[model samples]
Target: MTQDAKIHHHVPDAAPPPPSSRWSHAVEAAGWLYVTGQLPTDPDRPEAALPPGIAEQAELCFANLARILAHAGYGFGDTVFVRIYLKEFARDFRAFNAVYARYFPDDGPLPSRTTVGVAALGRDALAEVDLVCFRQSGG
Candidate 1:
């Protein structure tokens, strides 16, 4: 018998999160939640302004990511894969690692990840992160 799969969309209500011209914010399929790249975006602020630095931006990005995950009924432990895009890899890698380690200490399965250097991102943010998480069945 083929099992039926359910899909869910997670959107936080406090602010209107912008959608990528290419995809939805998050899509769940076959028990897996796929989240789109999240940037340090303050919807209330003007897009021309940039956040202070990599670390601050990373934290905000993660906070946005976490909120999306939560809305989809998942958490950090459910993440099985992560991809990070960095506009200034050489200058920001170290600081990024410091913040990253705090989130995935002990390495434990440590969601397979790929960090790539990029020329730019939406709003010219320094870093952005995208993740995939598996929801525990019946949890």
Candidate 2:
């Protein structure tokens, strides 16, 4: 198959991918969905002010990620990995995890994760998160 036939780009109507030609919100290839890092900006209103606190910012990031996942016909349960970037890692790690735990309950499968300290993120966001999900072909 050609590259176009093997890959699919996902862009939800509610949340346009960042204004750039270089990236998409999510891309599906060989039964895997890779979601780009999502920041705290509101998906419904990208221009609005970002959520102020780490917990709240983390919540928005997950919400944005969820939209991309669902748009590509995947869900949190399908996620196999996650990567988080925090502007204030030492101060906000616990609070960010508190909000993140809600999406991945202890009773259910939890994706492998890697979180790191970053000097900055787009929109001055306190947190940003990305996801990788396995999409069974022919689903």
Candidate 3:
């Protein structure tokens, strides 16, 4: 008989709660972690108002992503890829990049990324992000 790899559906207490019951914040299997899209929603007070401006909003999104990654024993260093959704791609792209560069420094390893303009996002947020991470062990 063969054994099957176990899967984990995680809703980290330190990360923002999922907006709906239909999804988890992250799902893990094998050596990979798939982090659901993170909005600027406050993890400690999810009902709070979102930050204003592209820089603040993007900062919040990265903060939220950081919390989710840490909860899974991962960090930006372990991130392999990222996908960002922006409400105003042309206007916010440069500002967002400024904030993003802070997390993935030029001297450090950076994850592959895709950023696209989106018509909408949950909570009417200006930005949202998701991550994909890989590790050698299933920790």
Candidate 4:
């Protein structure tokens, strides 16, 4: 069987920015979807101001991640890993955890995660997150 036969592949329906940068943003290969850094961009308005607090920003970040997973035919249950970048880890960690708990209650097979303080983020976002998920197959 060909590689494609061995494993189905899927790319998200979202498109990259028109003024292409060196980054590809996201890519899917061999049933795994790798999402790039997702900021707290409002679904209704991409340029909308991210809420001015860490808790709100974290929630929005998750919201953005959910959209990407949904578009790629996956869900939070399929997430295998995550990486988070915080502009102020010390000040925001508590609030971040509070918001995180709501989405990841019961520690449901928590995906591997890494979080670190960052000097900056795109558009002054306070927090950003990315994820990797395995798409379920129906035979």
Query: Model 4: runs farther than 4 Å from truth?
Result: 1-25
The true-versus-predicted C-alpha distance at residue 74 of model 2, in Å, is 0.4
| Residue 128 of model 3, lDDT score | 92
Q: What's the lDDT of the predicted structure labeled candidate 3?
A: 0.83
The alpha-carbon deviation from the true structure for residue 120 of candidate 1, after best TM-score superposition, in angstroms, is 0.9
Clashes of each: 0, 0, 0, 0
What TM-score, computed on C-alpha atoms, does each candidate reach? 0.85, 0.89, 0.88, 0.81
RMSD to the true structure for each prediction, in A, is 2.7, 2.1, 2.5, 3.4
Backbone-clash count (model 3): 0
lDDT digits (tens) for residues 41-134 of candidate 3 = 7778888899889899898888888877877778888889999999989999999999999999999988999999999988899999999998
Tell me how far candidate 4 lies from the true structure as C-alpha RMSD in angstroms: 3.4
Name model 2 segments beyond 4 Å from true. Answer: 1-4
lDDT order, best first, reads 2, 3, 1, 4
Write one digit per residue (lDDT tens) for candidate 4, span 21-62.
444445666677788777876766765677899988898888
Cα error, candidate 2, residue 39 (Å): 0.6
Top candidate when judged by lDDT against the true structure? 2
Model 2: per-residue lDDT, tens digit, 83-135?
99999999999998899889998999899999999998888989989899996
Local accuracy by lDDT, each model: 0.80, 0.84, 0.83, 0.74
Which clashing pairs does model 1 show? none
